[model samples]
Target: MASRSKLNQICQFCRCTPRTELKKCHKCGSVSYCSHACQREDLTNHQRACRVAREGVIIPPLDFLKTRKEKERLTEILTHCVPRLLTALYNDLARWMEAKSSALLERCINDLKLRYTPSACETHVLRVVVSRDEMWPSSTSTPGELFTVTKFQVMDVQYARESMVLWKDCMRELEIQRREAKANGLGMIAVVGIECPALATVRLLQFTGVGRYLLVTPAESGQRSHRRARR
Candidate 1:
């Protein structure tokens, strides 16, 4: 194994880090970044290498091709392809499962970070919500289209057993989601909650005498180019 000193002196892209906490690219284990900004700058190129040299290949399911809309396509890729790919790379993920609509889950998390600027306090429950627009493909879309929109309300916290193996299983899964670091470390199972589709903007909703939620409005662009930015 590379020593701590060795890790500190190497930079995967610029290769100028004489001594720093090597910011390892969570994907391909071979590359390390010197800083968060450095990693962000190298991400485009890193993904190419990661895809080619990473531990496993992810060929999307055949049904994915049949999905017409980009959102549906993305949904298929995240829900079907990603999990399968992670399972291939980490044997532990093969036995773990979390029921969620991929797009909504991602949208909610993005909305929280990009729009709401989440507080450091973890004691309060954060709600996620997404609404469908008239333009969005839905079950009522002309009778012959793929509309897979499901709403979810994921809690910021959820129940999970405590163990390195179990924590690892969750960590690997989150890493595959590209939201890996959110778990901070395998010290605890961090990403479990009420999975749901949320609004794009940060807003509050009153349900009864007193209740509110953070909504991620401005539905998905489906371009894949504007993926959630790193914090």
Candidate 2:
């Protein structure tokens, strides 16, 4: 049973305003305070919640295209190895698909660009199909071929997890590369995808420490799209 307050008070530590009685800490439930100011005063007991709350916030994606400095850095990275790596990846897949060369690679990159750009049509189908009846050639054979469909399915899940881990690693490496580029007075571009509000807050904080930020929402069609189309 909890006693009701005249006005529902939020916890100063976690900023949680309970609709009902504010009896316990929403985060740790270790200390109880009636108002936000009171919760802030209890530094000793609420420190854990403060730290946890900080970590819970999400960071938004970077919009490197808007910043000239960021764009330059990103271009440098793309110019070096990234585009080549992507080309190789696409070429390998296309080779497996019995395509001539890496012409499809450019198409895949265009599709990725179209997918990211607002108001762009989504007609590209990026799918990989494997035939069970046909025996895979030695060059195309992977560990996935030996296992049965059920086992291969499990392996595919594991591979997806590993790929996500690799993607995160690539992001970290890119951040380091961007920092180096900035040190040399070069512009860099970072494209980030923020799914949650917490992520958006975290990204703002992170970018603020690095440099200034100008928030840009997805632009609507008309003038903006016409400009993008021309570019």
lDDT at 81, model 1: 83
Each model's number of backbone clashes? 18, 13
Which numbered prediction scores highest in TM-score against the true structure? Answer: 1
Clashes of 2: 13
Q: Model 1: per-residue lDDT, tens digit, 5-112?
A: 776667766778655467667766777777888788878666656865685664343444554686577867776986675444222111112223334334444534
TM-score of each candidate structure, all chains considered together: 0.22, 0.20
User: lDDT values of the candidates?
Assistant: 0.41, 0.38
The true-versus-predicted C-alpha distance at residue 132 of model 1, in Å, is 50
lDDT of 2 by residue, 34-125 (tens): 67677657776556455556565322333537887886777567557665754554333334333311222223234334325421211112
Model 1 collision count? 18
